[model samples]
Target: MFGIKKFFSKEDPQQTEIIKLLNSYRSAIFPIGVQNEWISSIEKCKSQYRILITLPFAAHSQQKQLEQYLLKNKIKEVAIAIETSIPASYKFKEIKHIVLIASGKGGVGKSTTAVNLALALEQEGAKVGLLDADIYGPSIPSLLGLVDEQPTAKDDKTLNPMQKYGLNTMSIGYLVPAENATVWRGPMASQALNQLLNETDWGELDYLIVDMPPGTGDIQLTMTQKLPASGAVIVTTPQDLALADAQKGIAMFAQVNLPIIGLIENMSYFNCQHCGEKNALFGADGGSELAARHGVPLLAEIPLDIQIREESEKGENLIAQGIKVAEHYVYCAQLLSSMLHLQSAEASSVEITFSDD
Candidate 1:
């Protein structure tokens, strides 16, 4: 209100007979393209102001995604203000029995154990999905003969999972081109993993087996934090070098508070192909010794066999082929099931379905 100027400027000039026109209108409504119109009209104002609008209702997860997008773009304010809460996407719920196959050192057949254990679970009849989260060296695609395949599109923005040996499978390599290697930093690798988990349609599953890379690195940290991991299985050969790394793996998971389901001594001993007698090529009882020190179960001692490597490398489903090798995986899987309290019927459903159905 201008005080001095208004008091002095009122003069004698006056005009009579003025009419005021006013109209009352109802609440405004618009068509489908209303947002486009609003955006277009906003440019005409040029001035800036802030106001808040309320959304009628929204799913908590969807609201969070919207908030994240706004923050990502550094949006200071919007019409709608929300207390967004996004629910995390997980492969399974009440998963009670997640088995992670990991190693501290490389080239120790951790992948082999992971693949075989998943098949063993499948054979046992649990709805199982395998996640090849080994960003450094994902061998599941090659080992399972899924190297050339890709996941199918389930929806416009979602992907259907691939199946191999009766296990729902998702792998980093499956999403990328074959010739291209996913050589990315930690954040990028995490994004890839997030896509694999959130975008893929992995329906109800009994167990989700994760094949972790061999190391106590960022990837390992990300997994232990992000995944609702039930337990882990440490695989190693019987040797000081492998055992040393195996100890690191055990410790890393322990540090993250994940339970060690058991220890598997792969290539523990060599049963002479000709003599049929056990030979301690690496050392004796290294895994058992380690397990004892760590206070865990020594689940299995898989002897070093040419057949095992050959079968894995050649894309053969060795668990399906009954042998000393297959039985070792079966027994290890059973031990894990018992420790994790996995269901017997769910665990043995594969055998039942194949035989009965």
Candidate 2:
């Protein structure tokens, strides 16, 4: 802190000269042969200290003037002479519908709903992609059985998405073994996520379901602002303990101006697989009451089915299991499709229900 406070102890005329020179060329000239190709370009002329730059139309004459001044003031090794120019594109349009599946707290089956809903949407013949934005705990690879595979990139950048269950999937888990990544700070986690969103090959998708990292913090703040999230689905259980956290999560999204597509109360009631009698394990209709109070729909109240757990654990096709759980997920997907108006005349309409399975 001391060093930072006193970094510029005093100014020397020659030192001032160097800074002035670099400052003039900082935006005007760039290192020739730089790896990043998105912005302006610079190329070092053979056998000359002077660098050539393709001037951006932003201020061609101004950039050229600055570059010339730097070359004239070149003190050899102190600063390398380079060139500059605008080459189009410093901004791009973002994806259309990014559905963020989030929870105020973990262990409420948030990721489970995200993964299955993504697949369920895909099953309805919509182009879907899944992004495991859960930097701290990425479970898509494990749940979807993509643990062994890694996402391959074209060239040194631009990753090709990994495919599973008719959905294009990419996760930090696919980049490395699950739970192997160290605790990432806010900035580091954000940087990794930026790479996933900007650099990866998401292509075109009807829905890009982002499995948000639990807790409303830096990650949530970044995604809600940076990504074009159409709406969010908050997953929660009926337990009063979890409800508090879920409310906080909903508030965070609302603060960022994202729509609440409704709430899915997972494990709302437990069904005895043997007895076939339903029991309110946590408390019935708690999520519905919460949704109504918040003015958001109680989209679905999913039962605590053993088959749901078994399928997730075994990495089996969940839809293959004929049950109300599968239908509920499919129904949620249809609701999302309707929200986004993804049902096109060109695309065949597929009826998704329990009986279809």
Candidate 3:
């Protein structure tokens, strides 16, 4: 039997050891981080050695640390290529990842959570797009203060998605009158949503958040089947009734084999502006218990802040506005992003592709 290095001619002893060292090392972002598994292969050229690494999330620190370690090990003049793989159920030529934001019933601030989450993901270093899938009660146009604004067509067949607050947006409200009701049955609504998703030109999006209509009904089920969703996040209030419905939302995704990223508790509590006190107006630990019951993480507990409402109504997402309320959403965004990367790492295919600059 031949040794592993027998294939490569004049393979440097230090280079082989450095490769081993990289493979054994682990970082916080990837507790089991290493080369060989993450990297495709190491190539030895006359001028420079090249190694390609694919990561579920960007790790600038890890890259720097690895470079420094290689220098210390007397291994210089190496080229490192880093690329990302966002897990998806089905492949979209343009969009890399699609996340479905859902709720069991209406009036749980599902749309608000979806809007802020999209902005937060954009802030967190991903190209994000927002799709308003709620045909009957499309609130995205109103939330973005574009209820009167109309989307133009690139041609007779394609409609240009509207943009606001640095996010590409498509909504039924943009096409039809705000006051007018959708009056769409199941199949019609599903077709309209599919048309919006397929017809709009969302260019090279990292994350396309579909603000699903509230409920575990046809629209939600249809999207799970049609869209190549990376994962889903359920939104609910910190109330028993809301938590019960949220469980159903979790179960719905589970039934369709879509991974549940986590649960977000909207209006978890209220902060008294004057006295500087906290109030669990609905109930405490409801979302937490639901997450525990379903064995999913409780991602965030957003407060019922008036400013969040005011800013949202004014077409300014709190995350974009940089208000104090933005911190919670930002935290949630970070957690969501981290969890997504972790899940993708576990679920992604082993084939690695690299981009060199």
lDDT against the true structure, each candidate: 0.66, 0.67, 0.79
Candidate ranking under lDDT, highest first, comes to 3, 2, 1
TM-scores for every predicted model: 0.68, 0.68, 0.76
- lDDT tens readout by residue for model 3, 53-136: 665553422456677666777687777666555444334758877889999999999999999988887775667789999888
Model 1: how far residue 152 lies from native, Å: 0.9
Please provide the root mean square deviation of candidate 3 (C-alpha atoms, Å). 6.5
Per-residue lDDT of model 2, residues 22-99, tens digit only:
433432112211122211222224433333323221122233344455557764423233232222221233344677
Sorting all predicted structures by TM-score, with the top scorer first, yields 3, 1, 2
Instruction: List the candidate 3 regions with Cα displacement exceeding 4 Å.
Output: 1-90, 179-181, 349-357
Across 1-357, the per-residue lDDT of candidate 1 in tens digits comes to: 111222124331110000000011111111011111111111111322122212111111122333344344444332223221111223355343456888889989999999988888677545678888887678898889887888889988788888988988888888776345456778877777777776778777767888987887777878767777777889999989999999999889888988887899999888887888989999998999999999988888988888889999998899888776687877677557545542232333522111100
Using TM-score as the yardstick, the better of models 2 and 3 is: 3
Best by lDDT: 3
Q: Give every collision pair in model 1.
A: 53-79, 124-347, 124-348, 124-349, 125-346, 125-347, 125-349, 125-350, 127-206
With candidate 2 superimposed using the best TM-score fit, by how many Å does residue 90's alpha carbon deviate from the native? Answer: 18
